[model samples]
Target: MRIGRTLPPAAAPLSVQEVLSGVAALFAGKRAVERFEAELRQHYAVPHAFLLSSGQAALAVILTALKRDRPGRDEVLIPAYTCYSVPAAVVRAGLRVRPCDIDPRTLDFDWERLEEALQGGRVLCAVATHLFGVPADVGRLKAAAARYGVAVVEDAAQAMGGEVNGSKVGTLGDVALFSLGRGKGLCTVSGGIILAGSGPVGSAIENIVATLPREGWGDALKALCYALALVVLVRPSLFWLPRALPFLGLGETVFNPGFALKRLGAFQAGLARGWREKLLRLREARLRHATFLERAGVAAAVPLHGAVPDLVRFPVLVGDPAQRARLIEMSAEQGLGVAAVYPEAVTRIPELQGALAGGAAPQAEQVARRIVSLPVHPLVTQRDLERIAALFRAEQGEQKGR
Candidate 1:
């Protein structure tokens, strides 16, 4: 068991001042939520913006609204190797998941496979995710989607501050969502933002958002408690305590579709008072760490295309699964914060057996088995990066000897 300074796999810590602001917002009524929504609209330059309870809730709401325009189309296309929350949101919205294979190098949809998937007329939307803050080619995906009259939902949940050819990520697709949960580019205890154009689809989203209930005071208080704990324990010096507690499920990847759907609470919106500057600082730190890792040549880094990414975690492809496992074990023992992102592809998830509409995705399965992500959050230090590099070198040496 790690008893020393243990680094969290990923974190974007909330400050004490931010928590205090949230406490103050609790008494400010609906003004806090309105200000937050206005900020989001101005930043992303969208005609409509809404803050929801969580990223999954934002996605579920978007899917539901889009489905209203295309009642016959009940399928949502997604990456086969992405975060389980993507599929879970689709399921929550009462839609079938049609997973397309991803290109292992870029972790984006395989153009050929995506083209084939769009041939069928049952798809409602294709979700283009910017996984790990690496910007996916939404323009290419959108072009192909438009051919089938399918809408594109830019899942910028992990890439809020990212850019492609000078265009912000959130404005690329017909609709977009950004996650404000822990470890994301920005955090407000827990929340999500939706940006949409001023069209029929946007009107539908507004209607659905208006009907959703606001978060209750009880839940807002609980979120404040979590934020307080994060401020204290998200550091390397004290993270070990929480990491030792198995019940907290610190790094576990779960697929539960029963998450709550509601409007953002005033307290959480208050937590985002200075998100613009904070987001840029976090992005710069992540890019610096990722650059160091890339130069170290310890593993093959994931391709970022021509876009500038605000990576939350720097992902690398390890050729041998046994070697990857050993690296993760060594990192854990030394508090180096290495992680195997998702255990398996979406098609292999047990809960999604009958819910998926596509056939097998061989490349996505390969990526699931071989990919490992390293910590690139603002808290990561140069010493931490050195230790991580040393671990990778030692593991490579051992593999060669064996």
Candidate 2:
């Protein structure tokens, strides 16, 4: 009768072994960090990989390095409907933000609009995000950026193991960043990886990381809190506690850019090193759910376009703001862990108003209003999927009746 068992929006499930390993890592030190970097390099087949404090830090580092090389090209082109952190990182890197509208169907860049932005000039780089585990056409995006001589940075923060035509998502771009936060594919509680092509960009990243300060005690403590929080709150039952607290703002989106740029802590690295294989398994589980949902008439947040997605969450557009709101509320009331991905488009967020590229992003705005993501993490069960499908079916029936 209780449908509301808390489902984590995204998670790296905690285990006794993981807990013990994390404790042991407190003494193991930066060797854990080095080990993770090596493992990541081998997995992605990238020649260079650096472990950093967070995904946002990874982007900031890459952007900073690219900005250093081309001081005159100060603008970074990003999809209009992406994490606030994308534009935040651009601003952090001291570059101007140029928002390109996204296709409602693909959740990737609107190709024509992107070309317009690129041809307009002054674009140092363009970010291609594989949103909600759905892979973008990075190859096409790259070809487009290549025409403008603009570098492509792949935001695989949510799609760590995702592939497109046999190539890993992270390796498709000139440089890529992946997150290991609470709800990402790999969670060291909070960590990130930067992988870049072995060229000027790679060299630049290396130089910058070498000069960067190591994670301080404060960062390590924060990682500990994240670790503890995951163990306690990652389940669907307890997640509601955080959601209910207004001040915690558990699910609200904001554009504050005050992140501390630091290197990855050794403890977080050790926690993550053993989890890469687990993440691949989770990726498989999510893919199964995504396929079932699509077949059942739930529209994907982004169209697959033949690319494989290692989705962090399964997102869909419920159609219209009111209907989407009803689904989110009804699903959550039943403990379904259905939720909005982002509250607004990047251009619409009050803080980032100055960052827009001076045009209306109608698609981004529309997608923002109707989009909601459902839990497809490792913990979601067959029963949970059935419950979710039933809810969707019921909603559809209601719409038909209307």
TM-score of each: 0.98, 0.95
lDDT of 2 by residue, 242-356 (tens): 7676797777676767887888878777677567677778788987876776676666666654343667888888769999989987887788878888888877888777765
lDDT for 297 in candidate 1 is: 60
TM-score of 1: 0.98
RMSD from true fold, candidate 1: 1.3
Runs in model 1 deviating more than 4 A are 304-308
lDDT of the candidates, in the order given: 0.90, 0.82
TM-score of predicted structure 2: 0.95
Best by lDDT: 1
Q: Which number leads on TM-score?
A: 1
Displacement of the residue 360 alpha carbon in candidate 1, Å: 1.1
RMSD of each: 1.3, 2.0
Model 1: how far is 103 from its true place, Å? 1.0
